[model samples]
Target: MQSIHFISGLPRSGSTLLAALLRQNPRFHAAMSSALAPLVSANLDIMSSGQEVSLLMEESQRPAMLRALFDTFCRTTTEREVFIDTNRSWCAKMPLIADLFPDARVIACVRDVPWVLDSLERLFRKNPYENTRLFGNDGERATVYSRMESLARHNRLVGYPWTALKEAFYGEQADRLLVVDYEILTKAPEKTLRLVYDFIGEPWYEGHDFDNVEYDAPRFDEALGIQGLHRVRPKVAFEPRRTILPPDLFKKYEHMDFWRDTAGSRANVLATKRATREDTTTA
Candidate 1:
């Protein structure tokens, strides 16, 4: 089977752009997100139901069925040799993924919590004609405080992914994870991609042109009343802009990114070293 990896982390953290640049390599297959995780969850629920019929199935059957499900879902018609499945939920499913695909890795794209919320709010204002499904379809009409509260609550975008990423970061599967910062990725695409290639044990390809990459998910975004939510600009450069959020609201999450150390440097060195050691041993 072709190697499979996961792309997850906080929303509005450039997962789409990363996928776009990675897809530029003809040997790779990647997208904004996939339904495989939710599908697997739904199937597991059915099999684990307390009903007598469900109880009849052996415990071993569940894993085998899920393995088959992923194999079938990731199977492609093209010659793409690597599959990078994107989804924020995957951060919470690291244990399951580790058990299923022992060699698979998860590349988590992350950014400051305040900026992530700000990015979502900016998009909300840009599409004033329709309400986004993000906050129950009334995100635009909702007050800033209310919207912020909803997103910061546990199990939501800012909450769930942040908690999940941290869980995996400090958990036993930390070595199988790679945290990519939004600032570094946008400001230095080539350097970041090289690090990613090294982490995933893929041969480096210098053909990537971050400046002209194109990516968008109009159908998915439109269905959620978020027109350009998943869109990536033609260029990969980061243009600093003023925050649209209230000062208090922004301050509440301004210092919430836990992936960085006290000195504000990325703190996943241990995980990176482990990945390097594994790559070296395998190579």
Candidate 2:
């Protein structure tokens, strides 16, 4: 790929949909999360460990080695001019990416913390017959409260990327980050995509068909016992449904939306007006 960018942020946010839309541009190759980030971390750990062979790792070669990993992992996409790698860990690895791809931009797809929990809760409730891989033991999947708590732990699916996103948003490379609100994207996708194109400095792709968008990962979702986890509707209209969380639980995280309070904000946001505020409260 000639150019490399990143897509990352909260779970249940619009990263998957963004990828589905972006790949419409033949010059771009975008997809679900890849093993590249963890692979990079593992290699670095091995090289820096006290093992005798660790001495062979030259400091001068670290950048080349790390970069080659991307080159090799993305070798199949050579025909595509841009590769928008989607990995939540990329937000945590901003410093490394800064050193590797100076011109790269990271688009963070985000939603209010409570709404994020609510969406996950809806998925958990949708498959009551199958215990999800999202939580380990039966105890963790016992109720909406249990499931939400499990998913919000520091190392869990929702929290890790959320924490890493906050890190990138406040780090020295904050200028490289652009925060996209999920509500705004669903409310006004075309305008949102226009801003995204401008942020990544790509030519405006005016061929998007919002009503015909399609993306799904049945195998991936099925493996996790969540049939629609990565599913995107064929059309892109925002669905207005009451949330499924308990009232107290929903209110607990309502104020956790740090991205909304831009008192000293450095990241770009598209959340001036929330799209479906009237339907935000969960039933």
Candidate 3:
């Protein structure tokens, strides 16, 4: 039986890094988050086509729609032993999708909460899709970012729905379900990759080259286009090392240790006061 690995976690939790590393292995076929684009678009299309999809429909049935939508993916990968899909937020709907994969492994990629929010804020201005999809209009984007309370609430709400599944799945079959911390993964890529390979029952081969494993490089610009295929853009080469929050705003979120350790820590806080100091020393 073919197996599916559901790579999930909060957004900006290093799911991309984990997914990229997994894709380096020849036996693994990493689908990235694009696996669900068709299903999401199809659902929207159906609703737009005047077919009423009940919000109360049982979760089991949702997977049926996805099964039909992802049939092409399943067909194309008949030769592969494992098919992977890395969508951190998809954990919220795992019950609906897990039905399609009886022989699947679920991997949760997590990061410190504060770090997650810090990373999210960087994308706030550029992320137009969330404004339209979650909120009614793009005008409210500024409002959402301006209010500290609303931003925190939004972040919590965004990730809360997936917590229960993470608890239960990891609690019951700890080995089958993996939780990889973003910090550890990035700091020690080869070690983490070995653990992931072992979990999937794949042999570790020495002299394997991982330095130039191509990920979502081609889809970067395509992601900028709102229309067309709607491919989820992967990480790019350059990104801002830290987000600069206002003093008042920093004070509000300072209690989050993960954020403090990386961005708001004593060293970081002090460094900000001293201009020309090395801000990139550690985070």
Candidate 4:
């Protein structure tokens, strides 16, 4: 692969769906949560001062090895010209990515915070008999309020990526990021996708098809006890529904979409904050 980009942002914010669409381009390789991050992270650990072997490793080789992970992962796996690795951890590792892939950009897939929580809760309830591994135990999943509290903690799924996205959006390297919202991705796919191509300096693919899409990770989801968690629908369209969250909890996070308040954002946003949903058909 010639260039490696990233797909990151809040959980349940359509990163997998973005990857599904990107993979439609013959020259692009995109997937849900590639192994590159974990590989690079492990290498970073043993190469750091935390490991005595660090004394024998040269500082120059660190970037080389880390960058190799992306290249090797792509080259060995696919012949595609570009690779868009998906991982929420990438948002927290912006400095490392910039140093390694100087010209690369990170595409942050985001959604309204309340909807993010709703998506997770929906998945949990979908599999009524199985408890999702998203929480530590039963008590954590005891109620929608508890689930929301756990998910919104600083280190958990939704909160960590949200925080990391904020850091990247406001940090010195903010210009390396592009914020694309779930609403736009699902409701206005072609337009949103073309914007992504422009953002990454890729020529737009004209033959893109929004419907007849396919993406699923049954094994991955089953392992997490959250079947269909990473699945994308065959048709790309938004299905608006009433908030399952209790009124107060939903109200608390409905306005916490930090990406919307772009006053000081050096990053470019490709979406409006939550729009007034309508019943019109996107197809």
Task: Please tell me which predicted candidate would have the highest lDDT against the true structure.
Answer: 4
Runs off by more than 4 Å, candidate 2: 273-283
* Backbone clashes in model 4, listed as residue pairs: none
lDDT of each: 0.77, 0.82, 0.49, 0.85
- lDDT of each residue in 39-102, candidate 3, tens digit only: 5556745644345664546646665766665666655754566667766445554444545665
Residue pairs of candidate 2 with colliding backbone atoms: none
Q: Write the per-residue lDDT of candidate 2 for residues 54-87, one digit (tens) a residue.
A: 7887787878888898888777655688989998
Report the error of model 4 at residue 142, Å: 1.5
Return the lDDT, model 2, position 225: 93
Pick the winner on lDDT between candidates 1 and 4. 4
Off by over 4 Å in 1: 49-53, 76-79, 137-140, 262-283
TM-scores, each model vs. reference: 0.89, 0.94, 0.60, 0.95
Q: Write the per-residue lDDT of candidate 1 for residues 207-262, one digit (tens) a residue.
A: 89977988888999899887887888888786666777787887787656566642
How does candidate 2 fare on TM-score? 0.94
Report how far off residue 197 is in candidate 4 (Å).
0.5
Clashing pairs in 1: none
| lDDT tens digits by residue: candidate 4, 160-263 | 99899989999888999999988788888999999999999999998788987889999999999988888888889977677777878887886677788789
**Candidate 1, residue 229: lDDT:** 79
TM-score order of candidates, top first: 4, 2, 1, 3
